[model samples]
Target chain A: MSEERTEINSLGEFGLIELLTKNIEIQQASTILGVGDDAAVIDHFGRQTVISTDMLVEGIHFDLMYTPLKHLGYKSVVVNLSDIYAMNATPTQITMSIAFSNRFSVDALNEFYEGVYAACEKYGVDLIGGDTTSSQKGFVISVTAIGEVAPDKFVKRSTAEKGDLLCVSGDLGAAYLGLTLLEREKQIYLESPQLQPDLENQTYIIGRQLKPEARRDIIEFLQEQDIQPTAMMDVSDGLSSEILHICKQSNLGVVLYEEKIPIANETKEMALKFSLDPTAAALSGGEDYELLFTMKQADYDKIVLSEQISVIGYMTDISEGAHILTKGGNKFKLVAQGWNAFQQ
Target chain B: MSEERTEINSLGEFGLIELLTKNIEIQQASTILGVGDDAAVIDHFGRQTVISTDMLVEGIHFDLMYTPLKHLGYKSVVVNLSDIYAMNATPTQITMSIAFSNRFSVDALNEFYEGVYAACEKYGVDLIGGDTTSSQKGFVISVTAIGEVAPDKFVKRSTAEKGDLLCVSGDLGAAYLGLTLLEREKQIYLESPQLQPDLENQTYIIGRQLKPEARRDIIEFLQEQDIQPTAMMDVSDGLSSEILHICKQSNLGVVLYEEKIPIANETKEMALKFSLDPTAAALSGGEDYELLFTMKQADYDKIVLSEQISVIGYMTDISEGAHILTKGGNKFKLVAQGWNAFQQ
Candidate 1:
């Protein structure tokens, strides 16, 4: 890698944007326009368009000390794409707008865009259009993802019915545990500059926090199996909070079992080592970009063959309320202690 | 109007979002889903979807001290929508993602949302989806606008031909003058807290900068008159820069007349007061939010009757080069002194 640092002012905003996006080839047929215009045009002639946006602020959503610019760029795109996937739609295009302060160089921006392009290639989504501007402070990234779905095929968070099976893709609590490990390491390094961080054992958790992928595979798997979720949402704000959201929006109650919740062995070990309950971390810890959804009982056999999924619980009548049944047979109301940006 | 400040943490991000978007009624039939979902769904059916995004960073794009939060919100939406209109499309939906620090209260957010809703209602566009997060410093807004256009009807900046008549909608340079006035007043107020701003006569220019509108009417008028532009773009980065963009993309040259460039009396007076050339201001001063387009020479009589339209100049052969004819009959190459976000 080159250590060249080019001032962004040399090429200017337009020049930089052109250089970054010049090599992008449109993969989606829906994308009629991509870059080099005031706006991009797409033709979703026979399908419905699903759109979602997410804004990631530096020092709030990421720490520059630990997070690489490329990873940040990739994660930002993934987060928004995750929402589109949660809609049970295939993401086709994304417009990413970013504002960075003078502290960053053109090379740094290039690296970030490299990550963005990598994600675009991996997901088969076109980079349509975006705005690049200078910020007065830290980096700000906003990505809007557009997906397409067949008519009446899109899933919603409010369409779950009673007796629906609650399911989640991938393991929980890993990203949150990863964050904890990184924070601890950061604190140690800050206190003692000579200290060498021992993170070899925490690779999985750290990676989960640093570069979590959206569950596009899960959506594809569901499609391959001919299964449509009655209600769905990405487990961004933790399993507990997202489940609560499904229950609240669907006007029903849920019963999630602790033992049934999928937790990676490494994540569980890390949680216990940190004197934190694994179940609590999985329930309340956020940033695990997995899919949480509910499907009718008729689709259970179709999904049961998949090893990447877990049947956590089931939806019940509204009067039953939202609660979790522990391995010890204790039933308690689920509380949303998810990551709140406003919490001090 | 009430002097109430509510901490956003009390209601949480979800609660605040619900409160702000609760009253946003869906006006566009294409909007299949609006808010309360992982992603909003739109069915443009046969029409091509036009998408554009813009990111506004505080202290870079706006100064919150003089720019009201409401106006800022409205302007942010308008800026993105303007890009969609520049493509000769009908804006159907917008997703606005915002990042704000702890200094802002829930009331402040509500005020911003009030402006957002106002724009949505006025434009008859749906507020579909967005992400609201905590900023480390000042406010950051990113808005993605989605519009629909009939097949092959959407205009581009790169399709102008030789002999096309260059046209502009509304007057130019007022917004730049407005910004100058506000900045001067801000400096005076900072130096002497006791002095009141003497802005009694600069209302038009001030309002132009504070609340610029996208030329949706111009699009409608063009549609009604059955005139399709050869090329089009919003006059965002000044007339000279936008014209240069059109010329560069279309692989043609232009001959813009100095005397024909529309300038408002208020703008001229303000520019003169600041010891600036009015023509120069009209050429390079940006943020006008007006339409700059080129149409076939055959459509001249159709647009000539419009009071709001101005025939600025005409497109020329590539060998002619892009140049502006001065009022004194001297021709000079058009230089792009557009707002470069990266310039120190």
Candidate 2:
């Protein structure tokens, strides 16, 4: 990246906004107006809109010491899009609001927006209107994603019934292991400024952490297969915690099989190298951005045709409780050991 | 007000979110789902949706020393709704995402939510979804307001004709004067802790500053009167700057009458007490949250029936330039002195 620094102060707030949003290309026919107005108008044309928001703060969410601005920007958007996909909706538009201190330059912001636009284009979502201002402290990002779905077609977390097959898309626990590796490298670099960090042969894990993509393909594939999920949510706060949410909200119980949990080869290798259990990481780790859903037993034959998905468990009655059977046939109650950001 | 503090950590992120949102009552018929889902679903029933977002950072956009959490929360929602209303639409839902450091208590956040729900009820909008997390520093707020309008009924800022009549709702600069007075009091309070600052008979201006209301009534009245604005926007950045935006975006100029600029009596007196120009304050001060709009000149007679609105100017061809004619017959160029949050 060029070290060409352009002071944000040189351009006023409006000027900076103009500079950033000048290249916005509207891809959605629903987008009647994009930026430059008080608001953006979208006509979904009878499709119900799905909306979700997320806020990412500096230090709390990401450490700039190891995170690139572009990747952070990309991850920021991908996280919100994941929520829309979790609802089984096709994301069509997004609004990105950001606040930064003087610590960031216009070029840095441009880099961030470049990644934002890249993700927007890939997801086929139009970047609509948003607010940009200066923060007195850390960089802050808030994104609101808008997706469209047919009326009564959206999925929820409380719709699963008894005997539904629990499924998740792709592999998990990679992003958490990736974060651990990056933090380790950052500590080494901090202790010895002259030493170059070792991060070879970990591109998949690092990419999972830095530029995690939302499971748009999973959503599309499920729709194309005519498999409507009884309950669905993204694996953002780990598989165990998310399954617990499904059971709790739907007033049902789940019997998860430990052996069936999907863990990538890279994730398992890294977890073991770090003296951690790969199964524990897969069940408790977060930020995988994979799709976790439950479907009727009738879709079993059709689901097996897709290699990208795994049937990890089945929903049981409330009396059975939410539990996971280990490889030794020992059942343990599933607890939400998910990341509690407020925890000390 | 209660000192029985509850640490946000005691209840984890999910717990706190449940506690905060457990009482949300869905009010919109278009809303298919509210909180607790991966994403909120809303069916506009064929109405176009207008969406706008705004991010407010602590110490830059607001000072918490004198800002009550409730008013801050109320103001946050109102400010975003003002934008939706600016589009000639009826606000239906909002998503609020807030991040705060350990400095904030659960009680404080509850106070803020109290104001948020109050504003939601008053505006007949639903709090459909939001994100809350612990920040590493001061509180950060981002709100996305969503509204519904009939097909092709939403107004824009660039559609005003050359001879459109310019109008604004309510008085201006009171909020600016109120901010000036409070800031002065804050300074005095810091310098002399024993002396209680004098703020008697300034409730109007103070309320305008601390708890500004969106011009919902103005939008309703315009709709009831069957008046469609050619162009409209909320005066968030000051009268002069907003008119300049209208002229620039519409590819037209404007002639604003200084004498017609509506500054309240209390605001004028307060400006005089501070040795400031009332007109200048009205022209440059921001956060008024009033509607500045342009309509067909033929609706002048009908618009005058409403005492809340004042016709201040008329649009002109680009050759005429944007200027304000003073009471003394001198014309001056209208420049943007709007609050640039990035300035040192």
Candidate 3:
């Protein structure tokens, strides 16, 4: 490095990626798109190839004190699958690379792979290749998932039209509440070694947080419904943040209904128990791993209202603000305050 | 995760990977091969696709005390590229991800990517996609490289025959000696904070360790020579270890002569300085990133007398012990004591 030093926070994660990669130009004819999108696309044989990656860091992403290695492994695969799902494609293969501190016993790693295997089995995705290395500190996982879809069916976040219905897969905020419960129990156990976690009533919330499933089923459901989403992305960073991404990319605004936002009863109770607003958790709390997509209103009724998919809002002209209408009919502008690991 | 506790050491790295993934069955028809080769192959459209991954962790892989961030980033990508080269494929795309502790400044990461960008430019590879996450420990890099080769051109480690010539790319042991010099200087600096390293004379060796290059050039040169290697692997884990992999897989043996082994002059001098056997370092040193391959004897005249490729030995039937003809004219069984991060 030069004698001059600059803090990482001076240029946030996205800013750093842009600065470092500004000179990068795609050289391969196979690389149809690079560096920007829900995933990279390589034109293969005849169909389009989709590739996406995600990395999970210990301590920053999870507290292994309460997070099981199996769930961590499973979640690592699911998060990448979620990115593939965001592109409206089914993941066929994934490569996982793990960096582990020796503090973790070999058995711990076995258990971790056991969970990865389980997710692979459930999703019908192949565990193709990976690297195993030793970290100087906590655990780290990076997975690159590859999938294929017809070039026409692939959804990009830059194509939402005005008046398109903003649909979401399943409920949100449950995972965030689950994490809060786990953290609380971890602290309680830390203070009193013999204290057992009273997690009897929070199974749904805790399960959502620990072993959240990717919305692969939604992809199949959309296929059956014959509705191609105009714009789509995974709700890993809360609905508000994802909505802003779609709006910013597609150059549109949205109007969301607070009453229409999906939140399970279990999540609401957990939020109340923690003395937190359920809506706030659903809006800004992340890691839901649900599909947030937009489709033309003409196809709304075609998507049979099931427990899994819900219509929460609709896209609007750019002049209209991206706002949330409360149950009391008051509108508030939406702004993103989602997780930013580089902020500190 | 059950009440049972098992040791991962009992399984070893490969064994652990096998046991954990034994139950995973590929369900996607596009996935042609998985988990058993240097890279995974997926049938896309009409073309066969290849993907490989590798991860590097600080302390276990490199000591940042003497290593520069730029070189670390470059080596991380080079290491992954070696896997592609091992398969006799040319890498065209890469996804680079990093997890770093707050100790790393934005400028430091920029320098790191500067190295990565340099390698990409040198190799004609594209940076397609990646993830950025926060690590609570030292820096970690995980790279996934995708490449394409005519299905028939790809080589495996299990294809060498009895009469094939064993060829290695460039020289060996230089990287191993380079690491020794860097470690010695690091200890000196630790003892006396103001001590500047006497690094002028050790640049070649130290540079090999700090900024090793993958022999992608050899792949291109071999193609030009019209000599396809029967079996090949990158010498990341020492010549003895890699040769053993081919022997165990192809059921063959090899006879190597110490006098014929290539060692750089600087490396030999550094070995004597450290009171280490230069030949021993050449035999077992890891991270040289040289290609160890076997070719048909008919192609001997084409590869020999070339400055870039060296004919080191020849393959034999399995009954013949894999032996090394020492400078003293005594044949000794080759020992495999390759680098092991866990044991470190």
- Predicted model with the maximum DockQ: 3
True contacts preserved, each candidate?
0.40, 0.36, 0.88
Looking at model 3 chain A, which ten-residue stretch has the lowest summed lDDT? A335-344
> TM-scores of all models?
0.86, 0.86, 0.94
Question: Candidate 2 at B89: error in angstroms?
Answer: 0.5
What is the alpha-carbon lDDT of model 2 when measured against the actual structure? 0.81
Q: List candidate 3 segments past 4 Å from native.
A: A1-5, A338-344, B1-12, B22-24, B338-344
Model 1, B150-248: lDDT tens per residue? 867878877899999999999999999999999999999999989999885888999999988989999999999999998888988789988988998
Which candidate number would show the highest lDDT if scored against the true structure? 3
lDDT (tens digit, per residue) of candidate 2 on B110-145: 678778877877887766666777788899999998
DockQ-based ranking:
3, 1, 2
Question: Against the true structure, candidate 1 has what lDDT?
Answer: 0.80
Taking the tens digit of each residue's C-alpha lDDT, what string does model 3 give over B48-124? 78899988888888888888888988988898888889889889899998888889888788889989988888888
Residue B150 displacement (Å), model 1: 0.1
Interface RMSD list for the candidates: 17.1, 17.2, 1.4
**What does chain B score (TM) in every candidate?**
0.85, 0.85, 0.93
Worst 10 residues of 2 chain B by lDDT: B32-41
Tens-digit lDDT track for model 3 on A1-344? 56877877778776777787788978888888788677888887678888998888889988889989999899999988889889998888999988876688777887898899889889889989998877778888999999888877889899999999999999999999998888888889999989878885788999999999999899999999899999999998888989998999899999988899899999988888888878888888899999999999999888756778889999999999788888877777887862221122
Write out the backbone clash pairs for model 1: none
TM-score of 2: 0.86
